[model samples]
Target chain A: MAQVVAVTMTVNGVKSTHHPEPRTLLVHYLREKLGLTGTHVGCDTSQCGSCTVHVDGMAIKSCTMFAVQAEGANVTTIEGMGEIGHLHALQTGFWEEHGLQCGFCTPGMIMSSADLLSHNPNPSESEIRHALEGNFCRCTGYHNIVKAVQNAAHSMAQSAMAQAADD
Target chain B: MYTSEFTYHKASSVSDALAQLASNPDAKLLAGGHSLIPTMKLRLASPSALIDVSSLPELRGIRTEGDTIIIGAMTTHRELEFSKVPLLSEVARLIGDPMVRNKGTIGGALAHADPSADYPAAILALNAKIKIQSSSGARVVTADEFFQGMFTTALAPGEMLVEIHVPASVKGAAYEKFAHPASRYAVAGVAVVVHSDGSLRAAVTGAGDHAMRLTKLESEGVSSACKGLVSASDLMGDHFASAEYRAHLVDVMASKALARAK
Candidate 1:
């Protein structure tokens, strides 16, 4: 039998509480308990970054951390980024730039890129590639992924400048 | 894919953690959870309980004290990578990806002492001191005396590593590695530190059972001309690279590190 632990977290702007096995990973908790299926698990090992998410504003591979460790923390999944009609800049950039051929790794790539863009609004192409070293995409060969991140950065900067002008 | 059942304890202080460890001999301290969690999931290490110390204020901070920089044990790799400490920060930037850096702690990496871990070479090269705390009090161990073997250290059963102290007298230092493609671990990594007094220390990792000082190269003054001084047996081989190849890469990496230091 496994020891169960009570965890309370603010996931996707919603407060959630649950009791799960202490061994339950944060990835499994988000997928099984919270029903946020956007976070994919390509490799259970920490090597693959398919399960990337934002923990207190920092990108982390969900499979590497236990759910109990995130108690009282704020978690952001891909679903929190935007709705289907109003997609995030990364989502649209990926769509317009053909960043994915298989789409399995898109959520993680986009989520990891989201954290990157927040930290570096105007990352160079090499910087985008370096920031995405952890999150891999078997499809697309990363050429288009690099283009998509650059596209997003350009648009995000334009919007920021637009907002600043309005302000 | 799943870890064995274990209880979780959130430790508020070092004494509280030590008390818990005394009560449960099989309990392990969890810092950053980057190293321990993965091992736990593989069932390679099944502690009866995990004492979470990632958030302990007592074990988190980076400060300069005179000629030495004192870094709290819980300081994450991301913090170190961005910090002003030259050689240490350079080593931190080469560890894993940003996500891994955000969660991997220097103390946890040092305590685990993976054969390919990056910190050991840097610590040994910089002549850093490790501060360990037990229920009795605190003690310091030199980097050479701290690392005993692969997956082993000088830490007593109940003692907690509290801080790392690095001297600031390095004129220049650099770490160079031939990284394993997938894991980014050093296949043959070398750290070279040139002290302000013109003396040097050299350390190698991922080329042996544990990170070790390359005394021959240090004595020879860490130059491109010292490649022939390294012995073949010091290099390790596996599915990744042959011992001969690793020895070759050691020379290559050491030369690169020396160039960067210069």
Candidate 2:
């Protein structure tokens, strides 16, 4: 008696509907049904943060939520974040600061870091470390990851200031 | 891993959720779904249906009524962490990582009653009360009577927890915990609160099968008397630490929290 439910959500600024099993995790739905594979499933148990995404403007582990639960919510995955040419500041920070090695955890890391920067435009070194407690990166010893987030934070702040000055 | 198939019902109100729960033989109330969904994926639980109570407008606010602060069950940890309630905000900050905090709720955490969970310690120390409702009516239970054992609560089968009530005038309170490196759950945690009358209450979690008040410390009537109050038999331990080590940690964590409260 498998149940299927229809869920409608706004993803990457587009309204969409999905008919998935009630048991289908949001992460699986994003990667399989929508072909949005940028959201990885590092640990199905929700420990690893490779499946992180923004739901209603907050970072959450998509693997832990059912697709049906996200009905009418706004979701943002890595694919929706930025394109290859028009990269998000976090993507560029990782590229410039050597934040990642294998690139497996970059999407989730960037999403979580983006959330931290948005909530706190300026975060200290320890604040960045504390904010990233859920996200695990087995590569680069996390030093470069911290540096990357710091770089992105500064860049985003400066751009906002520049835009204000222009205005 | 994927969870076994189950029907989902999005309830618009508490009465609607209660009706669904009563109709389904093995229905579970879903609030935030952090604890239940993970267990379902592991096949630990197989509910016939899930009654989604996360969207109920009545169960989602923080307000003060007279001398008590009432917190709606669906209120997320992120909301409580930044709320005007000082003791709650302090404890909510240490519940889990940012993402977990974003999705976890106070009522869900209390109902789940994970032995290592952070809320039980603070709730017990603050002498909080839980408000639960059913199709028949609603009733309140004190924190001491609400928690029965690990993953067990006093909530009846058809009942859903709706709010948490705490005294508004806590003179001083603090929480201290030694978080597990991997899961970030507390290995040993203590919450101490000094009431307006100057009597102190202390509760310890993660060192036992369920959160319980440190009666010895309370009997001493002061924070400084908490040292050497915990015995080895008072703690339960696993691969992370031994009973003896946890007993020692209970003392250390309690002392640090007591100092902060003082």
lDDT, candidates in the order shown: 0.90, 0.90
Query: Model 1, range B1-262, lDDT digits (tens) per residue?
Result: 8898899999989899988987888999999988898888888999989999999998998998999999999999999988988698999988889899989999999999999999999999999999999888899999999998988999999899999999866899999999999899999899999988888999999989899998878887855464754676876789999888888888888888888886
- Tens-digit lDDT string for candidate 1 (A34-113): 99999999888877688999999999999999999999999999999889899888988998999999888888898889
User: Worst 10-residue stretch by lDDT in candidate 2 chain B?
Assistant: B221-230
Model 1's chain A TM-score stands at 0.97
lDDT of 2 at B74: 96
Superposed model 1: Cα runs more than 4 Å off: B222-224
Q: Which candidate leads the pack in DockQ?
A: 2
Off by more than 4 A, model 2: none
TM-score to true structure, per model: 0.98, 0.98
Q: Pick the candidate with the highest lDDT.
A: 1
State the fnat of candidate 2 relative to the true structure.
0.94
lDDT by residue (B128-193, candidate 2, tens digit) is 999999899999999999988988999988988999999898888999999998888999999999
How accurate locally is residue B140 in candidate 1, as Cα lDDT from 0 to 100? 97
lDDT tens digits by residue: candidate 2, A1-167? 56678899888998889799888999999999898999999988877789999999999999999988889999999998889899898989999999999988889899899889888989999999888888888888899999999898889989999999999
